[model samples]
Target: MDAHRKQRQAQHPSLTITDMYNVLEKLRSGEALSAKEQKTHEQGLVSILLQLHTELDAAVAAAYGWPANLPEEEILERLVALNKERAAEEARGLVRWLRPEYQNPQGTQQTEIGLSTKTKVAKATAKETLAWPKTLSEQAQAVQRALQLHERPATAEDLLYQFKPVAKPQQGQRLQQIDSLLQTLHGLGLLRKTELEQYVK
Candidate 1:
């Protein structure tokens, strides 16, 4: 039983409310999650469901003053309702964080960076053939650093800056190299440039 518990723990580490919210947010926005990220997200969802199931089961048992066992359908129905309530609560919280003050489209409002500009950049960046110059390990390191910053649609400079010794100087001759990398990412549709240069998710 201890071994079983350990195995379960390894497979299903507990997730916090924020972890579930992040997973849901990524899914809602149609963001692509790598296999590892997807696995973590699924584990988090399962953990939330299991917790809800236990709570509902206890509540029903207490209410009826009955045994631990309940009909599967009844349990499921209650769980569904609980999930809906949780979702609503989460949405309200998200709205508070996503209020208009923080809500800005990628450079769309600027006359200089209007639809045409976006389209041009997006088209250039949306090429499926373009690949990152970094190795898998290096790319993962860059992505990890980018995740630490509050910025969304992190600029090419921002990503390269995170690389430090691995990346060239920020200005002069290195500017063209940085631009080339960003353009490559944009062509590959990996990064979306938004208004105010914010990159989310």
Candidate 2:
């Protein structure tokens, strides 16, 4: 792991992984880092990591047959569309099992599960509502889309309502997830926070 980190660091000579970790440790422990430490953190690993992540995202988008430079709203929209398409395929008995050996077993035909009228209605409703994305990157993009649609600064609660109905039991967890994503988006400069603790793109 250290060697891999060093190789990545070598790709961006200005970034110092050690200094970044030191600064992060200080901040996480509620200790203030000096001006120099702060500067190192800003100019070091964080910037390099962001650049690397951008490249990775572009590559993944290309692999998905999507435009690499798509905006956050478009990315989330495309993802949602793809998800619905997959669900529709599954409804028609086309199950694309990732681990066929474990999921389908040998020589066993996959059975088509018939959907009831009520279940189909529920699914149609779900298709109209955006679900929380499973991956952190996509979740961040969803937050960005929410902010764009809001057209004004929005509190986390305001953004949460844009997604699919969260169960009462999961509301707290979902709120925390939104808060973390908000902080991450703010740190990446994809979002800005108002004095009132609202987020805007």
Candidate 3:
């Protein structure tokens, strides 16, 4: 089973467990599937893979101290709650570092540095939240700042959520504006666009 999973992952590195879950749900609902999804279904792999997906989800949920069969909405709610709890703990200088060796290499000294860094990051995040730039150039710089802070490639929509528009445009117009800003940054060689259409510095 592990070998099969590794093989599948190698073949489709971008295929996520959530994608498989959605495909299975669509199948159960008799909804029309996309061409790729239809092909997977025709290959008779959906049911087989879905069983593995379920087992994986159950194991993950158990590790998180959650029920094995939580609905997606409930899972999201729990995640948000946990995130808030962690944030509060962090504010109180209690950090649960995922990688102590890498994040705090110099022992107690590094831990102090990490806490100080987290405090600065928290302040920066609070200041940036819902505070959109007024000019296009400022917005471009803001995007760069956001990318650096996240330390990962982001979709335009992901970056869009980081700020509130100074003047609310229609949804479609707002998306176009964001795309244009990304293109401007790309042309200026300030950012790079991935094959997945995400932007990074």
Cα lDDT computed for each candidate against the true fold: 0.44, 0.62, 0.59
Cα lDDT tens digits, model 3, 92-135, are 98766443445656554322112224222122353465456564
Top model number, lDDT: 2
After superposing candidate 3 on the true structure, give the runs of residues whose Cα lies further than 4 Å from its correct spot: 1-23, 28-39, 42-44, 108-201
- Each model's TM-score? 0.24, 0.39, 0.39
Candidate 1, residues 35-88, lDDT tens digits: the string is 866775676553454444454444334322333466778767765775675567
**Candidate 3: residue 82 lDDT (0-100):** 75
How far out, in Å, is residue 90 in model 3?
0.7
lDDT of candidate 2 over 1-201, digit per residue (tens): 244457656775776767777765665567876988767656654445545456456435523445568988988897788688779987997875543445767736543221222211122232244678776556655666666566679988887887888789999999887886776656544456777998865
Q: Which pairs clash inside model 2?
A: none
1 or 3, greater by lDDT: 3
Clashes of each: 16, 0, 0
What does the lDDT come to for candidate 2?
A: 0.62
RMSD of each: 20.3, 17.1, 18.6
Q: How accurate is candidate 1 locally (lDDT)?
A: 0.44
For residue 195, give model 3's deviation from the true position in Å.
32
